[model samples]
Target: MPTSVSDRTGYWDRYAEGRSDHQASREEALKGAFGWTQYPGHGPGDEILGHPATTLELGCGRGDAVAALAARGVAATGLDLSPVHYARARERWRDLPCAQFVHGDAMDYLTQTDKEWDAVYSIWGAVWFTDPGELLPRVHDRLAPGGRLVFAHAPAVPGAYGVQGMYGGGFTGRQVWIYRWAYEPDTWSSILADHGFTDIHARVEPAPEPGLLGTLIVQSRKSRPHRMDDLTSSKV
Candidate 1:
């Protein structure tokens, strides 16, 4: 188990070595899927993004989804903590001018940058690994008005909630631990609402095949300001 950020980075860097086989084809990369179902293109796709002009992806593994958004002419940027993953994403999607990759922690980057995005998302990425109590507020602050936050990850096991620890890809004999959050769909929505988000939607999507694990998809928006006209009309 990695106790510090640097150690965590090393853990993921080592884990990335075994992920070459998981890289998506350029064509398929351009049309991304939100869930990890066996059936191709299953579950909600990028349309859930609602055509954001600018977007950010947290823990973008190989940068496929970022490239997919770039292909759609969205200004897309991916932030990953692993140097190896960052390098791969940069090399694989170099041709896409609108797609950029940054190597850094999500918390550090979000705190340092004043820039905002129309949408921010994670596909089984940071939203799973990072503590939502700490991460969600930063996400809300980094979104432009009416901007959205969307993420998907495997649903928690029965009665499991809050931070859960697990071993990373065990290709090697060394045991490495990583932490992820687990919550039911309704609980996830409540967490987002408590963090000042609006239009919250969180649901569990059944697996493509029976007996397989389902995915938890969550989406919420930074509340847009109330119109003064509407306020006045309501008062009248």
Candidate 2:
């Protein structure tokens, strides 16, 4: 199996205008998939974000959601490992007031960045690239005490993608979305629970498209100091 996945952010820089061949179609599909409705910042931007908010969009491909957030007047940043995609995101969100793009590993950038954010959200699923073991700790460090993380993940049976994109035309083939890890909701929940996030919730969304692919949406609140007290008060 081809182990090295395409560096999406870096990969986009090499593409025409930092977009894949299906960029336009993909946009239309997402628009069609979601009915082209604008979000009123029902995320961290739900209430407080309209004022001045910090948000991170992990693996932001062309930054559609980031643009959405900015449209709602939120200060948002996007991080992706592929320099190509990062460039693409930059171009997409360049007009926004608080939009910035970074090209690096999600874990590394989250751990290393000193900025604090109110919320972090990743759409179109990016958790497949994570190393599982290391992903939790690094994500924990990036979050503020009361931060929220929402991961829109694509779930599959374990080891399912060993054939599809791995054996394709160098991962550049149209409709090639090679994701590792079966990504059960419980698996991701346990990971978040272990990383000091509380109030975790996961739901399988209605497959907004006509297919077997599924989106497992997980939303977790980063624990505050009170959480430790909650655990400690269980004295007999």
Candidate 3:
């Protein structure tokens, strides 16, 4: 796996090229899927997001889900590390006025942006690739009060926790690799709670077919502090 940002960007650019023909159509993109299950519309849908007015998607590959949310009247922005994916997304969904795509690293964007989002999510995206310990706090800080954080990715292989390296793309003989984080559902819940999140829900959903890997889905909300007026009124 490449350690530098520029190298990682090149890796994803090649990966995108290998899968260029796999882009979803406009109608199919409107109905998004959160997991890699073979079954259509399987697992949780966007309803778990709770009708957010604005959303930011970390590692929004191809920007299908971002476009989907925008179609539902949410102002959605997708940030990706792969320039190829970003360009493709912009050209494909340019008609959607509410949807936007930006090419950049997730951590850098999160650290620099002053804007807060009603909800932030990733689908087999940056939340998987980036270090949660470093990434979660930044995500929490950028969320509005009671904002949501949701993500879905494949469960870790047995005994494989934290950063795991794997090869990607269709390259033969060349070892093009990438790094991802993997944790059990319980560990994921604990990590979110420790990061000051409330209402944490993390679970593994079975794949549509037997012998296939299951998807790990996690959802949590930023805790809203109690107001003085509400406390005083409750005392009366």
Best by lDDT: 3
Query: What ordering of candidates by TM-score runs from best to worst?
Result: 1, 3, 2
Candidate 3 regions exceeding 4 Å error are: 1-6, 21-24, 32-39, 168-176, 233-236
- lDDT per residue (tens digit) for residues 121-206 in model 1: 99888778888888999999999999999998888888988888776646574566788889999999899999999999999888
Off by over 4 Å in 1: 1-6, 22-25, 31-39, 169-175
Candidate 2, residues 127-169, lDDT tens digits: the string is 5556556666666677788788777655555555322343223
- The stretch of ten residues in a row with the least summed lDDT in candidate 2 is 34-43
CA RMSD of all predictions: 2.5, 6.0, 2.6
| Candidate 3 residue-wise lDDT, 15-39, digit = tens | 7888854466677666653343335
Q: How do all the candidates rank in terms of lDDT, highest first?
A: 3, 1, 2
lDDT of candidate 1? Answer: 0.85
List the candidates' TM-scores in order: 0.91, 0.69, 0.90
Q: Is candidate 2 or candidate 3 better by TM-score?
A: 3
TM-score, candidate 1, is: 0.91
Better of 1 and 2 by TM-score: 1
Error of 2 at 6 (Å): 7.8
